[model samples]
Target: MALEINMNNFKEEVLEAKETVLADFWAPWCGPCRMQGPVLEKFAEANPDVKVVKINVDDNQELAMQFKIMSIPSMIVFKNGEAVNCAVGLQSKAALEELVK
Candidate 1:
């Protein structure tokens, strides 16, 4: 399961993680975000080496602003606390997996 990340624990969980971190920025009302949820879940199950977390833009505006997330269903792959790859809107399992790779 993807961890539900909030402003309070974003630094500790994402910034300080030893492994590659995948952050999915989304909101409850966004249709694309909802659609991406299952893909993320399966990705988390398959990749034990990666840290997957979900950030709700409505609640964590500061983090969203810092990441420059102007769109919903944004997926970012982070290595060494820096964003290496990013994609906006809905993505298939293959595409999301490839983004991390």
Candidate 2:
């Protein structure tokens, strides 16, 4: 399972993380978010070095606004505390893997 991230732990777990962090912005009510979860789980299992974090947009509105998230299932790949890549909407595991690279 992806690490559940929020305002409290966002800095400690994501911003300061040594490994590349993949932050999935989602909400419980979102269908696309549901679809994206399993894909992330598989990816996380395969790639142990990469950190995967799930942020509930409803609970973390400030984070969503900070990242300019306009949709659920949006993914932001953070490298060295910076957002190097981003994908919005539902994406295949293969595509998401490629996005991490």
| Candidate 1, position 66, lDDT | 94
lDDT of 1: 0.92
Residue 8 in candidate 2 has what lDDT? 99
Output the worst ten-in-a-row residue range by lDDT, candidate 2: 91-100
Q: Where does model 2 exceed 4 Å of error?
A: none
The digit string of per-residue lDDT tens for model 2 on 20-50 reads 9999999999998998899999999999999
- The lDDT of model 2 is 0.95
lDDT of each: 0.92, 0.95
> For each candidate, how many residue pairs have backbone atoms clashing (under 3 Å)?
0, 0
Which regions of candidate 1 fall more than 4 Å away from where they truly are? none
Q: What TM-score, over all chains together, does every model reach?
A: 0.96, 0.98
